[model samples]
Target: MDGLPMGRRAFSSTSPSFRATARVGVAATGVALALLLVVAASGCEPVPDGTPYDLVLAEGQVMDPESGLDAVRWVGIRDGRIATISQIPLAGADTLDAAGLVVGPGYIDLHAHGQDEENHRLFALNGVTTALEMEVGTAEVDEWYREREGQARLNHGVSVGHLGVRIAFYDDPSDFLPSGPGGYAVATDEELDTIRSHVRRGLEEGALGVGMGIQYTPGATRWEVLEVFREAATHQAPVFAHVRGFGVEEPGGSVEAFLEVMGAAALTGAPLHIAHLNSMSLEETPRTLQMFEEALERGLDISAEAYPYSAGLTSIQSALLDRYETAPDTALERLQWAATGEWLDRESFNRYREEGGAVVLHLNTPEMEALAIEHPFTAIASDGRIRDGVGHPRTAGTYARVLGHYVRERGKLSLMDALRKMALIPAERLQEWSPDFRDRGRVREGAWADLAVFDPETVEDRATYAEPALPAVGFHHVLVNGIPVVRDGGVVEGVAPGTGIRAGSWSPGS
Candidate 1:
């Protein structure tokens, strides 16, 4: 392939010089030397001159929130890593002309639950490069990673879930979102030890961190929670949690839930990540952000994330709806059936609660949702999951919605700021757990080539409550590991370059 171009080589046995060389005793050697010289000269011939890359995105407005770089530039990718970012042209096997588009790191979803192929496709179309199961993570972390190997469309990872381990320890029948003994019964001292052992084993086996859905497992005592935190601290893994409760109402309220996790973080010295703070705090989201800021100020490694939507999704069988039996009106008023898209009244709520299905609660106001999203410290994460094809629009549209509504339409956030929340912040949060994340979430050279290219003026989410599977628009291309998973505004078929992102491969300081 490196030989001189076809029909361009100067070789002719009938020529006078060739004939002269043939007449000599060392004709073969002389001709070979001539050919070598010609080949060397051909190496200097003008071919495609720029540095060769596997892929090149040309003339795009590149943005890197971490470095605060936003400029029109050419980006080159080779061997699944960013090879160059230059003002000059680049040569590649494939080139995507990204004129008038914004090129940035692909969104990383820290609290995502949809790790299956279908949801991954949706996530790719929405410009998410990594989708993790951090809230209700798996019991068998090794099995989960193995099953998705060579099959996923986006980078994926999971936490060693407290709820899943508890269910497994108690032989509970639930597969996800505890409902039976795991949700309602306090564990014995021996049972707690078993659960802790399982969590530690999972972390050792490359689970991203410990996932605790304290709200799902109300029966989990403070001691059990503390034990999980201690295990997390030992492994230097952050704990991703849906706190113990929600709403501003007393007894067991959202404030108390926040305090529980905060105290655990303080006591056990475990990093804490609060999930879906907008939904959890609802009207009190501003206050919650203030608390998170204060926690940061106090030298606590605490962070939080929120989706753009004003609703939250969960299983009806989970303990989150346990209050519905008595105070049905307030709960039912905010609840909507995910499958049928119907606003749940007392009658419908009761039926679904017994039958067991996913429900969306309109627990947050639009103002509060926006406030949480605009919070400087809050990252954007989709608490996204899908069943069959029915689920929250956030499963397909969270990142795009932020770019579209929050940044472009409403001007609530700068484009760079939104990208920061979606990309750099999430990567920063998990880089301590896995060194693989270090090169992610940036557009500079030597970074992993996970990128999203979209029209800044046109990018927006179209998914809605009635039809939640709709993919976002205006994303010209989305690449995972420098492979185009989405091209020309559609998901490419039969390409899966995604790899499992695991922890424990490196220590925090390393």
Candidate 2:
């Protein structure tokens, strides 16, 4: 009995009380010793002497991917941070019965484009606590942060995008993504200097990092991209890039496009994050992933993200589809007009290209998607955006889809691994430059109380191409900064607890 098995030891024995008792060399009497043994056997941390916690989640499977913690514990939240995690129940002013639920760090979307109230509400239902516009970030970093300062429902941030800068530089006719001169005009030496100035200014204004939609701005020369990478490096910022090409079209295919950014990263020591590796790599996902892995092994500070989806959404007018005219009729047929959910032919494709809007391209195969998603190096990000409830399913379903389809149904990876991709990995990607991320993406004490409590059995995405705005199901409660944004499986209206998540090193004046 004295040498009880490790597995049978009390879970609460890891509590601060046990450590305190050990350090103080306290001896216990028969009754006191029995109480101590029972408490240890019960796995509840010895209740510290303190006022009751502000809120407590009781009897839940708390999963923290950072520490590989998977156990039933009571989580105590106070003043927007986790105060304690105990195996035994603790007193709280407010408590939620979290029985049969998994309480974990809220998901973080590093590539979310929809930062408005509408999208934030959906993001909450999807268990996303922080939604970042990293792939096609805003040109107006200050304005972007200011707009969402107190209006957003979930934590938000943005990157300063090269596409936005280029669009403004050329006075592009289209919004969001360039369709006119911004897409096609090659920059002169002076023009490059002007673009570089705007990029530097954006970073100075406290952008999370630089966003480069390389495919959208085909006119940007390799040297011009290298120049932008230099600017990001100057500020110790990462470059989140949509690599220049898609598919295996030789010359400028996915392999070469990946190399371009990796090369820039190597030359300038700029950290790089490739956006939507599944969409960017297309048919060559495996090869590009290998390349990404090799580059990481070579000591490059680089990472990639992918959503659990096959089709990708982008503006039909983007340079990405400039080749649509020459693309086989079969290819054109696969482009689904988001407005009507109708497949487009050459005529429809051209018509939509002239009248720019979102188009859902059914591009990659399921096999290819599974490959990218299952890879260990990739983080889970929703390169998702919705405007007036009219966007890709990914805008709403990305996270839940991963939890439901990939983790639960297919068993491609472990649930802990999925949480790591959604939470810890994304945070770690930015933590080097943004110390604010240091406390995020974990369920440990002193971490921000951004928690997502959901029923793993029924948790799933409900959004589809035909109904892209449908909110995901299974999340019972979502807390942002210890405030419930989603309660009882619905969005809690009239509350805006979201804050701007920005880099720690540089502020407005610094």
Candidate 3:
């Protein structure tokens, strides 16, 4: 490992992580030794008359990021929920041989942008069971939510872009329409009422909340954001923000500046999720972590996401990327399509900047890059945008790289710690918007059979900056709903009888 650092206790030096882990007794598996006791949660048992599950994943190695459990065990699954998890083996008609492999819940992606046919397969390849798109980039938020749910191989979730709601409602990117006591901006207060009605309608239509890209739309007023956040907060949905100045290096342009957006959430008591905080901080990695920590200490419910790749994927067409293009470094040179080996040259870059490629930025600091996984508020996201319709590395490389670099090679964090960020924490965060978020982040019996099996020693991310198309190695089996999607380094086509999941249509309080 070229850039491996110290304090990394989880890497397996002698063999694949799974083999090394297997040789050691339950006592020495690092944090992996602690999560063996996944007792049934209180008050979360089967209903009085509900039918039991269809399958059970018996004893192997169960890793629950929430409780930080990492040990060899057995799990029982019934009717798509976790039944019982213990060293005591229970009877089951079906079982999986997860011996010598890491078995944890499938990942919950907080801010994946693209959802294509191949990318769905690519996400399946990486063991991502649920993904929520924050910004409704190309499709209508209503249709996009229903569309992916209708066809995905993995369970999918969505956030209605405030930008989408704005554009869709206003249907015009014009100057001020009305705002003050007497003046109306979008139109009369009656029309403003109608727009607010539309935004609420999107939330009711199943958008998790709103996605705000403020820098991209400078014309959007703060009241506009507050207007919808109040509504989403009422519905118990958090606002997902791609805060104004992202991936920029200037005054008020860093990741820290985005905390102001987070502050707004805190002010209104709305849950806020910062989009790709890691992508914006290559040089100020320490400061960014501190800022997020301080906000958490302030009692703000804020979380963030990052991709494993130092570089992020987006088109140059983003309005915010254009404002920062005054420098040569910031100028779009060429965006090498990850899906295709072909290159979109500098000329194309400018054209796309105008036409909208929102070119992906490559993050290069080893420390800041490592922070993507090490930071507390941060979770893994691919920022995977749909290109004519193929997948990107983040879809295939994130978890594998989380294993290979942070835990296996670099030793920045423990394996269980990484799983917490990749699985449990994201699941908890999702729970704010979706009930399954709480249920899915662990490996108890009867939970969604979304599981990933891998040999720690050999499990490494193979995708590179140049070879971004290659899928990583080491995952032996991946199951969704008790159906094997990946078995022994091979993917089973058409077995993708996987269904989509919609969350929080029912409010606990309201």
Candidate 4:
């Protein structure tokens, strides 16, 4: 052990199992030893696999979510953190031949809804290692978080919904019915204070941020909202807003509602984020972006997120023409375009309609949909949901669809840009949670080795609204904390290697 590396080094006697796992090439052991020794002498930190290497993804189109690089490179992983990502022969481990694949920091989704295990499984198959669940409507959020732990394969995070907070902790229980009559009883300041207190407690307990379905609670006066957001802003948290109305339903469409969120930010001096812009921004994506750009220039902390699909999801109850305006079926049909009728499987819709929700689709313009994805400031989120025993297509198709349609076929965005939106932007937004997650949205020497490997040229999204359960094509390997979740297109099921991400900002009025 004299003059050895600070970390244990393989000397052919490290343990039969460890040796077997390394699978180091016989002839190059000397070269690997040399590189390991040099790195050790320079005080470089050790890799995950203490015995040297377990996996090395070699010579592939490496895409670092933060660096935004797509090139032929070798990424060596020991325990978990990528030890070396070099163009040279970064040795060790059983080689994962990614010669023609697109390698990326595992896709990160900042906005998503409830799609059950079936869809969660599909998400991993498609290479999304992390998903942030920002919907707060299901008031049973605390319990929801409890149930998902050690249960779902993908990494998950949650947000406290403003509307949910009001309904759950402050509202008179009986009044929590469907949106109707263009009005619902608004929460009084006394009631709002109680709800805000509940929200603050949830956020302090690691909830990501505030989620407001402003679309449902239009009666929530701006004053009450500013009170809530100002609280979030004190913690530098971003507020995710579900605008006052779906595009077609609103008098001025998506822009007016988005403008409302921005206006709130301006008034409250709080950061704001528009959720699922693809579904809501319709003919407004371009113009909305122009407004966003102005906000950015003015140094307003504002942004928007969207999924890759053109059709959006929601309850059939949301169709403005069907519920609010009573427009022609054709107009409602246009809005229905984006909603995934697949989940509404005639049976569930019938049940939900008979019992409560009337979930349906809202069709989106292909052009505007494309524009939303290509926008640099817009982060790519699945806005995915769990449904039935499976999940919505966004659970599985989002990242792959972006690669297939946006990067490969449509040429709407470069591979690098897409990866950044998937990982970096979401990661940046996640910083409000904790310092650990702050600078963690990248692929670097000391960063997490959570990785996704696919072939850009061959990567294709197989999940669709009609067939939302299809597994995506082209991910050959996926690693979470350096543990293999998916290896060669198959789930290594029984390993609970992922850790729950925790939120840290909590100083009351900070």
Give the Cα lDDT of each candidate. 0.83, 0.85, 0.62, 0.65
- Name the lDDT value of residue 421 in candidate 4: 87
Number of clashes found in candidate 3: 36
Residue pairs with backbone overlap in model 2:
11-43, 12-43, 12-44
Tens digits of per-residue lDDT for model 4, 1-510: 122221122112453422232233323444645564223211344543455456678666666756545445567776667767764444465778776566778877777564345655677777877767674434444565667777666677777777666555534332322344322457676877776787777777667777777766666777777787788887777788777655644574777777777888987877788888877777777777788789999999887888877676554443232342434434443332223343333344434544443243556777888888888889998877655623357767888888778876776577777778888888887775565565355777667777888766567888765666678887888877777778888877776555456567543243
In candidate 2, stretches whose alpha carbon ends up further than 4 angstroms from where it belongs are 1-50, 508-510
Alpha-carbon TM-score of each model against the true structure: 0.89, 0.91, 0.81, 0.81
Pick by lDDT: 2 or 3, better one: 2
Per-residue alpha-carbon lDDT of model 2 for 1-510, expressed as tens digits?
A: 122211222112353332233223223223444443223213455545545778888767788888777766678888999988865566677888777677999988999988788889889999999898988887888888887778888988889999999889999987789988988899999999999999988887778899999999888999999999999999889999999998898887999999999999999999999999999998999899999989989999999999989999888888888878787888787789998899998888888888789899998999999999989879999988889889999988988998888877787677778888999999999888788888888999899999999877678999999999999999999999898999889899998988898877667666
Which one wins by lDDT: 3 or 4? 4
Q: Please tell me which model should have the higher TM-score, number 1 or number 2.
A: 2
- Candidate 3 lDDT over residue span 37-139, tens digit each: 3222233343224432344454456777666567666566665566666454334556666666778888777766656666655666666777667644322
Best lDDT among the predictions, by candidate number: 2
- Candidate 1 lDDT, 168-200, residue by residue in tens: 877777789888898888989988888899998
* Model 1: pairs clashing at backbone N, Cα or C within 3 Å: none
On TM-score, the leading prediction is: 2
